[model samples]
Target chain A: EDQVTQSPEALRLQEGESSSLNCSYTVSGLRGLFWYRQDPGKGPEFLFTLYSAGEEKEKERLKATITKKESFLHITAPKPEDSATYLCAVQKNTGFQKLVFGTGTRLLVSP
Target chain B: EAGVVQSPRYKIIEKKQPVAFWCNPISGHNTLYWYRQNLGQGPELLIRYENEEAVDDSQLPKDRFSAERLKGVDSTLKIQPAELGDSAVYLCASSFGRGSYEQYFGPGTRLTVT
Candidate 1:
């Protein structure tokens, strides 16, 4: 069965602190791995899409790196505004567009 | 352009009652999706539509849940005889076309069953 697991269910970081969230996935055939940031009462916002192992993408203070079995979202000098639930999802290579998602990691960057 | 739109940001209903949620995807998007998100969990796909046809609905509980996307521009999801476990946020998303990697989402409708 295809599954996605996100670790560190909740994290509290002080402003300017750096940390990483983990997403481990098991799929029949890896097609794409995606990261999203969701604020309270809002739908998730797209962050990055890594299609292959050893691929990495960055935006401002956020960087995402992927491996064969997992992905890491690294936050560098995160600010309070960066606080939100980070979601991880994976798409299989079976020609279906449905995404299997993890429970997500709740991040709180305190000022 | 405008992002996906959904109506009735929040709703409270009693069990066994019928309720419906609506969604308007981004203009020109041919693929639309509906997902249910529980507290502390990520959104789960309930159905996927390609134009006016439903291509994936295996996860939807057909016994009580039904969805429709006529004209392929907007969609509606209805639940008959709601149950307590049905309380969750219903999110709608759309992509430019099939196989598109990026999807834009709406604010979602939060349903609370009492």
Candidate 2:
């Protein structure tokens, strides 16, 4: 079965603190890995998509990197505005484009 | 361009009642998806539509859940005789095409069943 697991269910960081969230997956074949940010009472906002190992993408203070077994979302100098639940999902190469998501990591950046 | 739009931001109802959520995908997007997100969990895909055809609905509970994407644009997801376990946020997403990797999401409709 394909499964995604995110580590550190919750993380509280001070403003400007840098950290990384981990998402490990076990799947038969991986087509893509996605990262999203979700605020309270809101749907997830697309962040990045990593297609292969050693792939990296960035937007503002966020950077995402992927490997064969896991992916990481690294936040640099995070602000309170960046606080939200970070979700990681994987798309399999099984013809269909269904995404299997992880439980997500709740990130809180306090000033 | 406007993002995916969902109506009725919140709904509270007693168990066994019927409920429906609406979604309008981004303009020109040919792929639409409906997802259910429980508290403390990630969104799970319930159904997916390509144009006006439902190509994927393996996860949808057909016994009580139904969805339609008429005219290949806006869509609706209906739950009949809703159960307490059905209380969750219904999120709608859209991608440019079938092979697109990035999907834009809507605000979602939060449902609470007592």
Candidate 3:
């Protein structure tokens, strides 16, 4: 069965502290791995999509890197506003090509 | 351009009551999706539409849940006799193509089952 699992269910960080979130996935063929940030009561905002192993994408303070079996989102100096739930989703090569998501990692960046 | 838009930002209704939510995707987007998000979890796809045809809805609890996207533009999701466990945020999103590009999400409708 295809599934995604994220580690450290919750994390608390002081302002300007850096951290990393991990997302491990098991699937037949991983088409793409996606990262998203969601605030309370709002929809998730797309962050980045990693299509192949050894690929990486960065935006400001957030960086996403992908490996053959998993991915990691590294936050370089987080801020209070960066506090939110970070979700990991995988697009499998199954016929449907739908996304399978993990429960996510709740990140609280306090000032 | 504006992003995907969903109405009824929040709703509170008694159990077993019927309710409906609407969504308007970004203009010219060819694919639309509806997802259910429970607290502390990521969104789960309920249905996905390519144009006006529902390509995938196997996860949708069709017995009481119904959705439609007429004219291939706007869409609506309805649930009758909602259960307590049904309290969740309903999110709508659209992409320029069917998963061929990044998706744009709406604010979502937070439904409360009291």
Candidate 4:
């Protein structure tokens, strides 16, 4: 069975604080790992996609790194606007378009 | 280019009632998806469409849920005799192609069953 688990269900960080959210997965064959940011009353916005172990991607103050069994979303110098629920998902190599998502990590960055 | 669009941002209804949600995927996108998201949880895939054909719907509850992508451009998800547990946000997303493509999501429709 393929499953995704995200750690630290909720985190409260002061402005400019740095932290990392974790996503552990168990899949038949790893195809792709995705990161998204969702705000209240809105949909999730696409962040990054990591395909292989040791792969990393960055956008603005956010960076995402992946390993064989897990992934990490590192927030550097986060701002109030960076507060949102971060979701991590994985797609299997079976050519199916469906994505298995984690429970997500709620992040609140206060000024 | 406009992102995925969904109608009726919020809806409230009684149990056993029928309701429908609409989605217009991004122009030229060949793949569309419908997902249900409960509060405090991530979105779960209900159905996925490739062009006008439904390629994956194993997670959809066929007894009460049905979906259609008429022209492969827009789609609709309907729930007949909705239940109290069906209250959740219905999200629509689209991707240009199949494997490994990034998906863009809509604002989502929040459904509340009383």
- Candidate with top DockQ is 2
Model 2 TM-score is 0.98
- Poorly placed runs, candidate 1 (over 4 Å): none
Chain A TM-score of each model, in the order shown?
A: 0.98, 0.98, 0.98, 0.97
State in Å the error of residue A7, model 1: 1.0
Candidate 4, residues A1-111, lDDT tens digits: the string is 999999999999999999999999999988899999999999999999999999999999999999999999999999999999999999888857578999999999999
Q: Write candidate 2's Cα lDDT for A1-111 as tens digits.
A: 999999999999999999999999988889999999999999999999999999999999999999999999999999999999999999998867799999999999999
Clashing pairs in 4: none
DockQ of each: 0.89, 0.91, 0.80, 0.88
TM-score (all chains, Cα) for each model:
0.99, 0.98, 0.97, 0.98
- Poorly placed runs, candidate 2 (over 4 Å): none
The lDDT of model 4 is 0.94
Worst 10-residue lDDT window for candidate 1 chain B reads B96-105
At residue A109, what lDDT does model 3 achieve?
Answer: 92
What tens-digit string does per-residue lDDT give for candidate 3 at B1-114? 888999999999999999999999999998999999998888899999999999999999999999999999999999998999999999999988765747778999999999
lDDT of each: 0.96, 0.96, 0.92, 0.94
Model 1 vs. true fold: TM: 0.99
Model 4 stretches with alpha carbons more than 4 Å out: none
lDDT of 1 by residue, B64-85 (tens): 9999999999999999989999
- DockQ result, candidate 2: 0.91
